[model samples]
Target: MVRNSRILIVDDVVDNIRVAMNILKEENYEFSFAQNGGEALRLIFEVGESFDLILLDIMMPGLNGFEVCKKLKENPTTQEIPIIFLTAKVDVDSITQGFSMGAVDYITKPFHAAELLSRVATHLELYHSRELLLKHNINLKAKAKHEKNRLLSELEDSQKEMIFILAELMEATSDETGKHIKRVAETSALLAKYHPCLNDEDVDLLYHASPMHDIGKMTIPLEILHKPERYSEDEFSLMKKHTINAYSLLSHSDRKLIKAAAIIAHEHHEKWNGTGYPRGLKGPDIHIYGRIVALADVFDALTHKRHYKEAWKIEDAVAYVLDHRETQFDPELVDIFQEHLDEFITIAISQ
Candidate 1:
């Protein structure tokens, strides 16, 4: 295959070109010629990756072969075009310099036609072999990536199903009714979509990750969670541990969604005024994941009926959030949430 490859010849010497062309053409190779490095560059660019190998002469006028080779290596499109120097300079330093400038091999002038043809055939064979190897590597990487993504999708689906079953089971233990975790996930996603710092992928991560916010409640006793009255100091102290429990439950994984879940689990109960439990983290000290979920959880709790109280109207819930913007919630997020209230409500109702 390589003997039949197209070879470009660059030399200022006319006799050398004729001799090499005659010898290589007999071996079934196609030939293109250039008188100097400058003309060779123009011809190579015009051909645009058509030649399999280049035979460059070092001592040509106006941008010698080394200069042409340097330019070709700098261009990603042309860099892989193999170059072999055909030069008269036989010194070790000259040969090393040509190889360093990206020549695959060098043949000194006063060269035998047989030697030139043999070197050309060898380099072309190497080039084709490299091309095959690169193609195989690319195919292998694509297949690996596809398999990884497929497994990731399956893992995410399993987590969602587990969350739904767990959330429903926990809700059954308490007095809450219908889609509490789903609503929080939807609202968190809605708020994140309009957030400047969050991209589409980040928003989706938060959306899926937010439902795990109360996952710690699974560890809390049913009596406390179902209590129809206010929590006693002892019960409240125990309740605070849920945040750490939440973090611990999801913190084991290094995945982005799991990490986001950990942040939400640990920080959602924190207050803007530094009074929140588990950590007295205040204001922007809280992770945006935590801040976003706090609002979602509160809004859903306010608008949904519980064993302890009737649901507040949407208007009343809005007023409550607006009233406590800096005290109970992150004010910037609160404002964005309020601005997109209709979208949030629409998602809530759909859920």
Candidate 2:
């Protein structure tokens, strides 16, 4: 496609320029000519992008074709412009040097007009085909990106449907209704929305993901999870196994949402001071998603009516969390939480 376009001829000899221009003219090909390497370099720099191919002479005064080709190769803007050497130099070393300096082909002097025309045509066709292949590659990348986004959107919708179903199953097993998990999910999303480190996507993921925090509880028997009395030592140990069960349930998937869900399931029960879980993970040992869900889950449990206890006042719930900052929560995260406490309460009340 590009070979059918403009070609530039560079040589100092007037007769040679006339002959080459005439040969190309009969085929209706457009062309430009420069007398010497210096003049050709100037013309190319000025309108280089328009020229598809060049016929270069190697024996010109003040910057020979080899020097010109070397200069063209140095300028990134003109480096890839193909050059065909039209010169008298026929020795093996000179021909090798022409290619080394970046000329695409060597055509010796006293040249046949037909051979020159045919070589020019072949190089131009190859250049145009390479351009077409590059365009196709760019289109392929864009199409692949579009398909990936579509698949991700479908997967997110499917995961939400599964979470809702799983939440219902958990509610069916426990004395507390599904509203508890729903409230926690809403509250966690609100907290993440106002958090400085989280973006809109992170907030949305946390919203859907936080509800699955107690999914491990599905493995705990109804007697331990729903009992209206304090748990015995053996029952408490079995109760703690819920975290591992939750991790097991969600860990095998490669999906990002499920991976996040697995992390929350395993670490939400972990305390900041290394004292409150089957693993006793401390401080940053807990992933940020787990820390965020921990605060949301505990706050909702404190402020909502439960089978075993009455709901505490909103102020009381806040005070309990603030007082136990380093012991129960990451101190730095608690500082961010305290700054956004009012908003958290508003979201809780609204929901």
Best by lDDT: 1
Which portions of model 1 miss their true places by more than 4 Å?
Answer: 11-13, 36-38, 45-50, 56-119, 348-351
Writing each residue's lDDT as its tens digit, candidate 2 over 134-195 gives: 89999999999999999989988999878867977887788667787778888778777777
Q: Put down candidate 1 lDDT per residue, 1-351, tens digits, no spaces.
A: 466788888889998888888778877988888999888878767655478888888998798988999998998877998998888888999899988988889988877877887788888888999999999999999999999999999998887677667667766766775488889988998888888898998788887888778878878998888888999999988877888987888898877777888899899999899999788999999998899999999999998888888989888988999999999999988899889889877765675
Sliding window of 10 residues with minimal summed lDDT for model 2: 1-10
Candidate 2: where are CA atoms >4 Å away?
1-4, 46-49, 74-76, 196-204, 252-254
Residue 46 Cα positional deviation in candidate 2, in Å, after optimal superposition: 5.3
Tell how far residue 296 is off in model 1, in angstroms.
Answer: 1.7
Number of the top TM-score candidate: 2
